[model samples]
Target: MPINLLYSPECLEYREAGHPDSPERVATIADFLGQKKAGRFLLPGKCKEEDLFLVHSEEMVERVRENSLPYDPSTPNIRGIYDYALLSCGAAEEACRLAVGGETSFSLLRPPGHHAGSKRAGGFCYFNSMAVAVKKIPGEKRIAILDIDGHHGNGTEEIFREKEGIIYVSVHQFPAFPGTGSVSFANCYNFPVYPGSSSSTYMKKFMNALSVIAGFSPDLLGISAGFDTHRTDPLLDLPLKDSDYYLMGREISSLNLDTFIVLEGGYNVKTVGNACYCFIKGIGKEKHGQETGKRI
Candidate 1:
C-alpha cells in the first residue's frame, strides 16, 4: 500500500515564531518528504464545528474563539488560531478516514494535540485532534489509543476515561509537564518512564502495554505518535534514538489491526523528518485490509 502523508500549507498560517512547536517543524518534515518524493501528499479540509463538540465543551470552543490572546506560556496566541485548530482537527479526521480505507496515512499537523482537554489548552494543543477523530467515528466498535508522546496525553485520557469500549495507553517520561498520568486506572493505562531511560527499557514497557491492548481486541488502533523522546530533543530527557521509531512502527504494524497515526510532539526539527520517514516505512511494509465504517 502506498503511504499517504496528509497535510496542508494552510497549517503554517497559524504560526508563532521561535516557539518550539513552530511552523518550521512541519515545514522541515514536509520539505524532506517532498525532496524525497516519499508519500502521496494529500490536502485536508477544515473540521466541522459539530465534530468539535464531540470532545470539547461549548465553553472551551468559545474560549479558544474569543480568547485569542495567549493565556498559557507554551500555547501561543496566533491570529485565526481557532480556525487553524479546526484545520488540524480536520487533518486528523482525514488521516483516520484514509487509514480506515486501507491506506497507510500520517497527519503531520501542528498545534499538536494530546495535551488539549475538554475546557483547557496547553502543551501547544487546543482541540484534542486524536480524541475528536475517535469520537467522529460511529460508536460500538472497540478502539485503542496508543500515545507515545514524551509527555502523557492527559487530555485524551480525560475525554475517554468514563467511556467504555475505548482503551487509552500512554508511554511517556514521568515527572514531566501536565503531570497527571502517573498510574494506571480503568480504561486508561499509563507507563511513566524515568529520565535517561534507554530505548530497550522503553520498548519493554511498550510491549507490556501491547499485551494488555491485545487482550481487549480493539477493532481499530490510533497512535498518538510523538518523537520528542528522541535523545537529542530539547524538550525531554529520554535516550530514544532515531531508529527506535522504526522499531515502534514495525511493532505496531505487526498487530495487523487497522491503524492511523496522528502527530503529537517532537521538537528536534533536524531529526523529526527522519523519524517520521522511518516510522512510515516501518508501518507501510504490508497492506492492511480496509476497515469497515463500523470501526475507526
Candidate 2:
C-alpha cells in the first residue's frame, strides 16, 4: 500500500513571529514530498474538543480555546490558535486511523506537539497530539510510542506513564529544553543523549530504543518524528545527518508493526524537507520486501 500523508493546508495558517517552530517546517516537507511523488496526500479534518479532553484537562482545553491563559513564551496564545491546534491534532488522529487499517501513514502537520501535557502547554505545543491520538484507539490493544525528537517529550511521558497497555520511549538530548527524560520510570523508558554526540552514538541509542519497543510487543507503534536532531538545526545539538534519518526509518520499518508518525520538531527549514523525504523513502522501501543493506 502507498504511504498516506495526513495533512491540511490550514495547518500553515498560524505562526508566531521569529519563532523557531515556524510554518515553513511542515510547508517545506509537504512541498518536498509532493515534488518527490513520495506518497498519497490526504486532507485531514479538525478534531473535536472532546478529543483534546482524552489526554488534556478541560481547563487546559478551555484556556487555549478562550485564550484565557497568560502569555507563555514557548506556547503562544495567538489568534485562532485553538483551531490550528485542533487541525494538527486531527491530522494525528487520521494518521492513526490509517495505520490501524493496515496502511503506512505520516501526519506532516504542526505546531509540533509532544510537549504539552494534561494541564499545560509548552515547547511550541498546545496539545499533545500523539498522546491524544493514542488514547483514542479503541479496545485493550497494546501501543508503544517512540519519540525521536531531539528534546524529550515530557508531556507525552507524563500522560502515558504507568498507564496500562501503553509504553512511551524517548531518545532525546539531555540537559536540554525541559531537562526531563534523563531516567526511565514505570512504562516510560528514556534514553538521553548528550550534546554533540556522534551520529553513530545517536544511532546506537536509537537502536536501543527500538529494542525496548520490540520487547514490549505492541499492537501499534506511534513515532513522534522530530528532525531537529539534524546537525544544522539551531534548536538542538545532536549531530544526526540526513542519511541517519533514513536509517532510523528503515529500522523502524523493519519492525513490521503497524506504524503512524506525527511531526514533532525540526527548525532548519532548508534541510528539514530533504530529511523528511529521506525518512519516508526508507519507510517505503521495506514494505516491498526490499533489502536495503544491513541495519545500523
Which has the greatest lDDT? Answer: 2
Q: Give each model a TM-score.
A: 0.94, 0.97
* Tens digit of per-residue lDDT, candidate 2, span 177-293: 999999999999999999988999999999999999999999999999999999999989999888998898889998999999999999999999999998998898787673345
Per-residue lDDT tens digits for candidate 1, residues 1-296, read 56788889888776676788878888888898887777889998889998999889898888888866347778766678888889889989988887777666888887788999887888889899999999888657789999999999999998999688999999999989988889999899999999888889998998988877788898888899988988889999988876787788777877877788899888898998888788776676544332332221
TM-score winner among the candidates? 2
**Which residue pairs in candidate 2 have backbone atoms (N, alpha carbon, C) closer than 3 angstroms, thus clashing?**
none
Instruction: Compute the lDDT of residue 73 as modeled in candidate 2.
Output: 86
Please report, as a residue range, the 10-residue window in candidate 1 with the lowest summed lDDT.
287-296
TM-score of 1: 0.94
Off by over 4 Å in 2: 290-296
Q: List the residue pairs that clash in candidate 1.
A: none
- Candidate 1: how many backbone clashes? 0
